[model samples]
Target chain A: MPGAETPIETIISMMVGRTLSNDALVIPDTASQPVALEVRNLNRGREIRDVSFAVRKGEILGFAGLMGAGRTEVARAIFGADRRESGDIFVHGQRVSISTPKDAVAAGIGYLSEDRKHFGLATGLDVRNNVALASLERFTSPIGVLDEAGMQREAVSYIRQLAIKTPSDTQEARLLSGGNQQKVVIAKWLLRDCDILIFDEPTRGIDVGAKSEIYKLLNALAAQGKAIIVISSELPEVLRLSHRIAVMCEGRLTGILPGGASQEEIMGLATLREPAMAVRHAS
Target chain B: MTDTTAPAPAAKTGPRISGAFHRLLAFSGLIALIVAFSLASPNFLQTQNILAILQATSVNGVLAIAATLVIITGGIDLSVGTLMTFCAVVAGVILTYWGLPLPVGILGAILAGAASGLVSGTIIAKLKVPPFIATLGMMLILKGLSLVISGTKPIYFNDTPGFNQIALGSFIGQIFPAVPLPNGVLVLFAVALIAAFVLSKTALGRYTFALGSNEEAVRLSGVNIDRWKIAVYSVTGAICGVAGLLIASRLNSAQPALGQGYELDAIAAVVIGGTSLSGGRGTVLGTLIGALIISVLANGLRILSVAQEWQTVVTGCIIILAVYADILRRRAL
Candidate 1:
């Protein structure tokens, strides 16, 4: 029982080597900032209801929900990775048509799927190729031949910038750890010049050290004016990183709260069943 | 926190070493087959016999390369043999039946292959059909079509003066005077070189491996996955066309019934070449070496008066051994 008396926050702080106070971080004020992504009544069968929300430039929008609350479904619908029954996605105040992930990327949106192995990283390919995968056309000549040297140079630079721990750019992605693999996925979106990024469970499988790094990286990316929506099941993580939190339950947006909203408040909204009650609580 | 969990550089070397080791094992196997054959019969290493082995490999080697492209994308092409026959029939119609020029016939056959491949790709990618089933259907369709087109008979290229020379004549022999390597082998080498280069240096090649590695990942990366998949299949079909021309030219006829069993051999060669059936990991060189192994085994066995049935048994055993070896290598890594 020696460590039983200690709080979870203290243990997390010890593991991450960082203070766990909300006061230590500066949350961005997005009231005056331009809206980077806005969705109007997004619907995708029974998985997602008429969900509408907006994230401003330089804002980290934390999506909070229970295990089956359809948070990932909403994100995938917005990113066009999954088909939506009815939805309108507006980027930079302009409505965009997105029928596929290709169209979403063309509209400057990137999605890092929660399952990295299945939907984010091509484990067999080397790091250089994965980093440049999203933006391959930039590295290709007019004749469709890839400029290998240019791709290598760009991959090496991203490896340095993202601090991806790999032996070389030529190292296959599967060999890297969870944290580094996440960084490689981040690097891919970054290299693609995607201004709007939806990261689903960004730190799901990462260790304490890499989780903090990813947190810092997300903060730094938001500071650079990237509109980020991080979908995480961990409430503390949502509270630690989000400027505003959006809570969902049973495919409906139960409520949206500020970053400093208490755990009890989020949990209340998370389990709220009635839409009428959610509207009252949201207001 | 410090990044203490990163794998050590030493740990990363395991796969690279084993990849090289696998290729080395395959190459040594090829060499061992040759040495064994030469020792068993003095006639096995003769220049004429070697040329005959190369000639036999030309058709299967080209088909295997085509299969390599598709297999690397985590897909299989079972229609390669019949598709080859179909293309040869197309070429026969152009040159022998229509009496068109030889260049036109050659171009026509290649284009025919590409078109069939496009159809297969569209079926697989757009219809969301599994590659195995899609290509299996294509195999039967093309087989029936080949028989129909050629009227269930061999379409002879006797009227086309240089048609037989495409595979039989040796351009290198013309220059070297002593080597006398057949043009079919030259074509095989040329196809291998181009396929290897495309797999290494082009966007298509990169996507091929990426699609096989994690197709959903590639699609999520904003790539047009269907387009690329279709393209891979189309290219595969075109390679099969080349194989068709080689087979037709070598025999001086388009034999519709001759191509049904060739796919098994091509796929066997691909497996023996260290290309994974599950997709995402393989090489053109590995496939080339594999094709050579098959022909060498077949030719060497015949030279030693081994029965054809037993030769097939040996080949079947070799395929299983090659795949098992691959599994061991992967598990070790």
Candidate 2:
């Protein structure tokens, strides 16, 4: 039912179902419509040109592109990891400006950065501390008082839930393997209650077993009606996990189609940028 | 969303219990030294000799603790000696020149040290200069300023004769009056305790370790590494301010030319105490012990009638050995 999206023209007539609020706007039509997220003329500029699409709840929005093809930029811009010059982003039809990562977190958007070792963790801190870092306010009193016991318990729960290979939450994050570190990243986002999750190269550098575990987690998160965007350089991954695929090339959106679209069609759109732009220039 | 998860206990690898025991082995060398020294001389075990050693270590130990924080952050401060002297001179100016109260003079000394340290942090963090070079320049500037401020002469606290009581007055000894330990020893311990608290607790302390571990990693995590680095330098500088107060208090005068080579001694104490100069691994207790080691060596040698020049050579050897031990430990880690 979320998959059958009537275009924005229909949504305009459905304004009677919208509720006004200060920071959060709840649209009655979009709320009950089963679509977790919808982007109407989502313009991220230079890289993403007049790109528009609708992704139903619990469906993965797979962004596929070659290296430096603006796919990573899209993830970054939407997650508020990087500021976009101009764009309209909505979580459940509530328009939001994500100027900073803190803002994104408050808006229930979580971004898993590709560079996990550097951006994702404080290695000196134990695994438990790293997991509790993002949502530290929840575990801490206003005056910088950290409830070590509560934090430790929460960390242990995440570790068990994720099946991470850690001796304990007390073990330093520095000592963990690559796959375990990625698990810690996922646990961090989940603790923050992020409804819209973005994973950039989620399985990069992970071994086969760990990759399977991550895929399983992604699938499970989707089943719970979380809006997911996965940007991967790997074609097979895009094919396997994506509900819909958006192919990009040379910093511009070339095509969008269902996940079942043939690789040949996506490849055709990926190479569409230069020839079409060159032709336009000549004209 | 899945909750069915087991807390997989980490598999044991290396000998856990032995590693901790090995860390406790730093005292073995000191024990051997004590046994050898006691056998060589009767006075080596005397209370007078012990007090003398502690008093001698008081200045260097305080300076060492200051250096330990910087060293732990993978940084070195070459200007500590001159910075200490500059602090003393500033206090001297406040006490004698402007006729300020004793407390103001003490505060002035520390503030002077902090101001210069702030400059060093700014140059290194904002201007992107290496810590070694930036602090080296600061050392020279402060050294020159000490002379200029004091007109190449000693500034005595003779006008406020009671000023000597800060470090010279042994409040602990007076309470007991049996040992009559100098107040300087108490100051050294207090400084060490405070430094330990700062290094082990607080957010600034965390970032200090993080900056030394991987600075860019910290920056990418959205932490303002620059501000923290500056704070580290300021803390180090504030400690130097304390050192200046102690030195000036002990000498009873702010000698313009007195603080030339103290930085080397402070760094030596830090290294000998087991703080890795390469950063990311250090402890305040290690630095305290390191200061004691330097002073004990000096005192033991003095009691054995070792020449002043030989004492310098032995200290140099110990410093090299200490740093080499650090390198080996780092490689092993």
Q: Count residue pairs with overlapping backbones in model 1.
A: 0
Report fnat in order of the candidates: 0.63, 0.15
What lDDT does each candidate get?
0.92, 0.76
Worst 10-residue lDDT window for candidate 1 chain A reads A16-25
For candidate 2, lDDT tens digit of each residue in A12-119? 334423321111111112223355555555456576555555556777888888888887777776656666766677777787766766677777877777878767
Model 1 quality (TM-score): 0.96
Q: After superposition, how far is residue B69 of candidate 2 from its true place, in Å?
A: 2.2
Off by over 4 Å in 1: A7-23, A275-283, B1-11
Error of 2 at A62 (Å): 2.9
Write the residue-wise lDDT of candidate 2 on B1-333 in tens digits. 433232333554332333333334445556667788899999999987888888888888888888888888888899998999999999999999999998898888877877888899989999999999999999999999999999999999999877787778889787898888888888888988877776655556666776776565454343456777888888888889888888888899999898889999999888777766667667777777777777777778888999989988988887787777656654565
Docking class of 2: incorrect
Predictions' DockQ, in order: 0.53, 0.13
Q: What is the lDDT of residue A143 in candidate 1?
A: 79
| Candidate No. with top lDDT | 1
